[model samples]
Target: MRATVNQGPVDIDCRPTLPNITVMLYKDGQQIIPDFDKILPIQKKGFLLNDVSFEDSGIYYCQANNYTRTIILTVQDDSTYLSEPEIQIPSNTHFVLGSPFSLLCMLNISKNMSQSNTKLEWVLPPSAEV
Candidate 1:
């Protein structure tokens, strides 16, 4: 999964355990770990990188003997493109006695639906009819 900067301790897995597992981690083309930690293989068969930053974004490679796995890691800024919605519910309304009263509620999701696949709905009161 892609993570934002300062958002994670990313774990890259090392697969195909041998009798003696010696895993090495590489980022881009440079090696990160020369020697595997003693407890890494026993604990999770992976490496946990704490508080990843933008500089940590690259193609990660896990090499253990001949078996290897590669992953593309993209780090993004925490800023969001969408702002809080401005809700405008009427503050005051007056109706005469025995007069029919109707209320309308509207929600705008135009900015939030660009990348979303989920649906949004508003439920009406049980006594209300459309």
Candidate 2:
């Protein structure tokens, strides 16, 4: 049966047969699950759409014919689209001694800087003035 929730589009579903039925959900097999979040009890052989969460991701079991059946539920992460920022230089990348070298330093930015053409200056160490 379609497990619609919050009147929103259904992401997952659950189906249990008769002979072992109840409004509340039960963990099948000998494995005892302490908490069953997001899943509402099945009262009168019907489940509504107001149940589910991202953390409720796992295998669920239902008892039938003195045996247990399994159903896997999963939620995808929205943060997967975010990419890592490009590094200007390796953390261990060091300069050689006695050689005048310039490294284009990157400014610490919280947002994307790719859209702007702004130039960044390398923050150099303090020079010794005598």
Candidate 3:
């Protein structure tokens, strides 16, 4: 499922909705329940995110007792109304020790995305090894 950042929340629930079964949630590959800030109680069964972000977009796993279900979440940027920005780095690279090289960040934006609200910013690492 796809959701827009700062627009609407996303919800997921177990199909069977067992009474005594304990529901657990996982984002990407890590457990995020209890510690997640956006989690909210669902209709007596499952949970929902109050506000989603690009980082929240990933494979969501729900473990209820022995039953497990997965949901793929694709969060869109509110500004551009597009999916998360993708940074592509070529495999082969040529860089001089002290020379400056330009890095390009790429993202797949469709016609539905807003061009005027899109802004790109580059962040540098705190320290460089070389």
Candidate 2: lDDT over CA atoms?
0.42
Winner of 1 and 2 under lDDT: 1
How would you order the candidates by lDDT, starting with the best? 3, 1, 2
lDDT per prediction?
A: 0.61, 0.42, 0.70
The predictions' CA RMSDs to the true structure, in order, are: 9.9, 13.1, 10.6
Number of the top candidate by TM-score?
3
The number of clashing residue pairs in each candidate reads 0, 5, 0
Lowest summed lDDT window (length 10), candidate 2: 1-10
lDDT tens digits, residues 27-108, model 1?
Answer: 8878885334321333445676666667778888888787888877776534422334444545787866777766564434
Pairs in steric clash, model 2:
4-49, 5-49, 6-49, 23-42, 23-43
Q: What does candidate 3's lDDT look like per residue over 31-100, in tens digits?
A: 8765456787564657778767777778888877778888888876655555666766667988788887
List ranges where model 1 is wrong by over 4 Å.
Answer: 1-6, 34-42, 80-130
Q: Considering summed lDDT, which 10 consecutive residues are worst modelled in model 3? A: 1-10
Worst 10 residues of 1 by lDDT: 34-43
Off by over 4 Å in 2: 1-16, 23-37, 43-51, 81-130
